[model samples]
Target chain A: MDTSVRSKGTLKLMIVDDSNIIRRRIERSQQIARLEVVGAASNGRAAVEMFRRTQPDVVTMDLTMPEMDGIECVEELIAINSEVLILVVSALADKATAVEAIEKGANGFLCKPFTDRQLNDALEELLSEA
Target chain B: MFKEAEIRTFIEGTTNYFETSAQQSATVGSPYLVTDGNPGAYEYTGVIGVTGARKGVVYFTAPRGMLTVLLMRMQETDTSDENIKDLVGEVANTISGNARRDFGKNFVISVPVVIAHDLEKVTTPHSRSFVIPINWRTHSAKLVVCLE
Candidate 1:
């Protein structure tokens, strides 16, 4: 395991976002920390499909996706599997959206323009969730 | 096709996007015409295209100095070309997305493009449109919505 990160397992993570910046950030963070980035999707619908195929340990979702959007994705993801840990990573996940995600069964909230530490912390929290 | 409400929503949405994502406190100004497309002092200007109810472009003009500060806030390292480019372009894209969400599913947004504006030579016709300036610290950005 990389000293910067605490895990070295084949734990998969699905990054869902339309912006290349976000996908790259999550992927890069995973690589630097040596985590397995299983898949990525540009929209919510695609993310759902990716989730089923990858069966990731965690999901980093962006709220402002075009087709299905984050809130809807959260709803769908939770309905499909409530045990999955979902961390919203978006600049648009404001107070209302954060509350909405929590209500919809998201594991945690992450405000965008965040650092790798924030990302790591979110994943750790999710991993600890039951 | 852009309505007064749209322009207002765009400005507000853009403001919220930057304020939240960039972690910068934006000094918002009232909406006005873009008398000259070029304003303030900066070497690079980033613009995001907006379509649908209105056919026009939204600019996130940042003086390099301002961009540096924004980059500093967006990431841990102060100097990453990828991060800076992504930060500037994504800022515009995100603001436009927020505005589009308000406009319902009718609007379509284009990829973000950052242009290096020669402050000394760039001339945006005032008659075409005057801009509403939103100053952020040392950097000033404009949100101009020219109706189609």
Candidate 2:
């Protein structure tokens, strides 16, 4: 696991979702988790490319996107860097997919319409497990 | 035809989405079945197709006023037409996604299709649509579910 970014005191985060509203919401709520959003992507394809470029410490992913869904993105992200922490923040309510994501290397999963407090708590838990 | 449980699930999804995403509570009115056209015509609508174990369509319709307030509550200062359309689609997607928890993997929701006007003409015909009225912050919108 890459602890260098977390050890630096401020984690570099990336938000990936198809909806602009969702991406902006996560960006606005980053303060709750004390993280810096270094990058964002609207689709999985863009997310993969951005992940390679930004190499953020953590990534918030949304499933059911247009270009590339979250499941595929998670696989690609983990393949690229097994150390990177991926938190699935998606509107998908399927437990099967959530479990699949974990099996595919996602560190955590959170449903949509979450509060800032909930978001902060999830991030804290993910980081703690790291 | 739609099952009572299915309708209840959709209502819960709509309520949860509003409360969490917009920080606004929503009241769901009685659900009624409609067969010819949309229950109530609106300026904007977000439609999503459901496939897999069940085949159907779901949508969220709202007037410009309601959509504007929703956008503003979402921290969007620019309630432009484009933003309103985007907001509507996101709301519908969130609601449908939430329902998947109750419906299980059998419910597969597609990406949202946003309609700015003339929803009645494009709405699916023959299928029975359950129209549920939702009131939020004095503004009103409708959640329509049509299944095969």
Candidate 3:
């Protein structure tokens, strides 16, 4: 009945990935959750650029991308803002990869082929920590 | 050489990916003997390198339409050709990751690799591979695997 998170300020978020499809998916899904999309970036470099500009509350990032990879992106983003919630949205096929993201200051991971419930769960998991 | 529980998990997890990602259910069927025929009718081969106890490949091959559908699921939307390549690589990775859970936490999984082609490309080194017959609702395909 009350899906609107009830937070006075919206969940300002950013999505960085090489695929427009994935961006659109996160966009549409978060639209239902009503998260405010600060903006989107096509690659890691753009992600860093937008991060500096928007300083979003959360970032849904992909591990593999052009101009830079997700791991590298996390490394850079971490240096700038260690407090930001960076949830990896990736197709990395190994637990180590997931572990790697977390080790690199990422807040959590969002495995590919995830359901909307999963997306929400990971989001809530990170948000709950906040 | 997979235990019943392990194989069951592989089947269920991979099937879940197909259902939510591919928007189709995998139809259970006979074991597709990889040595008997080809992988599928794809213009590219979706592969993830395997190492540690088992060293080989988890490969996926299918037509663009079928592959496109699977890719769309992975990326979570209908995309153009530029995105399709990325989606294929990611889907292959996701499937292998799902299957990796069956190997328990002892084995290793590498990054997904995409080789554009329609021919059967063998993963050599004389390693033993497992062939999982994946049925997609009405259609079926072979998931070629090996354990070093």
Candidate closest to the true structure, highest DockQ:
2
Better of 1 and 2 by DockQ: 2
Question: What is the full ranking by lDDT, best candidate first?
Answer: 2, 3, 1
- Candidate 3 lDDT by residue in tens digits, A1-130: 4433234357789999776667877877763253688899988999999999998878998875667888899999889977778889875546877887999999888878777777888887887776
- lDDT by residue for model 1 over B1-148, one digit each (tens)? 3445557776776667667546666878877654445444346655655566656666566666676787666553634565566566677666665664456444556666666645554333233443567788877777555545
Q: lDDT tens digits, residues A1-130, model 1?
A: 3521134344667899876667876776653243478899989999999888887767888876667888899898888877667888765433565677889888788765565677777777766663
| Candidate 1 clashes between residue pairs 3 or more apart in a chain or in different chains | B33-B130, B33-B131, B34-B129, B34-B130, B34-B131, B35-B126, B35-B130
What is the overall TM-score of model 1 with all chains considered together?
Answer: 0.60
Evaluate fnat for each of the predicted models and list the values in order: 0.13, 0.65, 0.43
Lowest-lDDT window of 10 residues in candidate 2 chain B? B119-128
lDDT of 2 by residue, A19-99 (tens): 887788778876644578899999999999999999888999998889899999999999998988899997788898789
* Tens-place lDDT digits, model 3, residues B12-75: 6567778877666876455433443343435656676777765666776555666666655555
TM-score for each model: 0.60, 0.93, 0.73
lDDT at residue B82 of model 3 (Cα atoms): 60
* Chain A TM-score relative to the true structure, per candidate: 0.84, 0.91, 0.88
lDDT of each: 0.66, 0.84, 0.68
Ranking by TM-score: 2, 3, 1
